[model samples]
Target chain A: MKVRLIDLYVAFLKIGGLTFGGGYAMLPMLQREVIDKHGWATIEEVLDIYAICQCTPGIIAVNTATMIGYRKRGIVGAIVATLGEITPSVVIITILASVLTRVQDFAVIQRAFGGIRIAVCALIVQSVLTLSKKSITNTGTVLLFLASVALTLIAGLSPIAVVVLAIVAGLIIGKVKERRAA
Target chain B: MIYLELFWEFFKIGLFSIGGGLATLPFLYKLAETHPHWLTAAQIGDMVAISESTPGPIGINMATFAGYQAAGYPGGLIATLGEVAPSVIIIIIIARFLSNFDKNPKVENAFYALRPVVVGLITFAGLKLLQIVVYGEGVLNGRAMIAFAILVVGVLKFKKVHPLVWIGLGAVGGIFLNLGG
Candidate 1:
């Protein structure tokens, strides 16, 4: 099942151009095009790609597109698909950034932004709740969550360092648990 | 020089912002702290709104927006390239090998610890934004507070509604409610 580079580009282009809010929002469209429409990959394959995308350090949508394209047509496929995916974002945001900056000083725009700002706050709160529901499962994780919040908010520790420390903590906890089980 | 800096900064953001698009918020906030001339806290609020409403990854859009602010169109291009370079390189290498990286026990445990902490980081960033928009100068803005309350309820209740709808309502309300700050 050889997929043309052009086909890969077009498929991801539609995926990128249509989906809003990114992340999981792009999943349905991705499944539709890659699995249902083109048969480029199976459902399980798409799910696997998604799992990899979650842990990987990049935009999930771009990662998904890159992985799928790479599977279909190697490195060139990955590059082409990535370009297709980001084209919409670069174009749309560049235009909007230009226009918004120009008209940013207007009072009406300010008031609109005022309202938009509140909406943004609400959106962030929802994400916090959603992520907390998924992440805070046990007492250990609870402590980790609280400590992280305190470190960032109260102590002003760098999050990058916190992330690194958490990785170390996880590795150690995992090793200890493995020893106990053995 | 700005382009190089934007490239380097976003490259770091791309390399470390694991979890998802929202995960980039903390790094962007740090960017605001370190390079206030490039962008500000208020501009980040606006970027979130625009990114959510637009058709793209929020992380990429933010990088592009910030890059554009820093330099211009070329800056946006360079910043985006920097952001995606790591993804392209890492994923390509993994795909070449074609193994299930997530199946490893150590990888699984690392994620087990990573998720909760990442959530904490995102929560902190959200709180900072909330403070800036709803209580800038330590004085609560009444209209923004009311809008915030209503939107929170709206989001929780009408979970199916797209964010664009909420943003649209907010814009209209901002104009009509005279929510000028």
Candidate 2:
């Protein structure tokens, strides 16, 4: 059955609406909506889509919207899906910017922001834990993790350098693993 | 003229921002430096706060907000479009390759390798954000810090808890207990 444009739009809308923190936190919700609810994508596809989004430039969530939407419809599907993903931000932020300019001094607003920032941190930490649990499965991955954290955090190495090195390292490791399996 | 400049500026931000949404901060700061009229340092801090808490991608939210602040709704629209264009274009070109891309040993390995890096970048981003939130101004107050710890523990107790629930609880706690201010 072909999913209607509006249905696709609504799906992203719901995903974007419920999502807080950032792109990583949105993945579980995205999987539930796109895979479990609609069956537009499978688990493996979702993972690969996420990987692709990670490697590419721009917002991961918006890229997810484009890629998943394209899968659901085509190019047009991508646009509407992106629009759906961003609509909430546009509305909410626009309202915030206008209204916050006025009452930003209010103690309650500061307190609320203080509260929200903590929750955002907790969610981000949860995502970090989930990823590490999955990725730190081998010695090589462990070394890579430590090296990466050092390069990025301590040395202030450019993230792109870390990404490029990881790709090459991954290729070598993947090949070695494949040879062993074969 | 200003809209074109906005699009071009954000287009560059979208193009080079690697890792994830948090990576956009430096580029935004650079923008602020180059164009002081475009945004203030204080505005960027506020943008970070709002983007983190809002729905959609943080990068996109940032582009829209910064863009709006620069040139209203039209600026917001263009900046967002510019920010997202690279990913949309790149994904479209590469996604066709990805279905079978996973089968290739190198592609598979590269992705496996990339996961930790993604995790690393995310962890770094989270900690930095926590540092700012928990210990703003490089000085801490016992009560606020305690409130934060309690909230974190309470949220972490539920295995696989919905993130939205955390957001709601944080809001309620913030309002009721004055955890933030």
Among all candidates shown, the one with the greatest TM-score: 1
Give me the runs in candidate 1 sitting further than 4 Å from their true place: none
The residue pairs that clash in candidate 1, if any, are: none
Q: What DockQ does predicted model 2 obtain?
A: 0.48
Model 1, first chain, TM-score of 0.94
Residue lDDT tens for model 2, A1-182:
98889988999888877787566878888988999999999998888888767666677788889899888788888888988888887778877777776787888877776677777677666656666787788887888888877886688765657777888888888778778999
lDDT of 1 by residue, B34-62 (tens): 99998998888888889999998888888
Write candidate 1's Cα lDDT for A54-163 as tens digits. 88788888898889888888889999999989989999999999999999999899889888888888888888888889889999999898888898889988778888
**lDDT for A148 (candidate 2):** 79
Give the 10-residue window scoring lowest on summed lDDT in candidate 2 chain A.
A122-131
Best by DockQ: 1
lDDT of 2 by residue, B62-122 (tens): 8888988888878788888888777777777766656654355566667778777767766
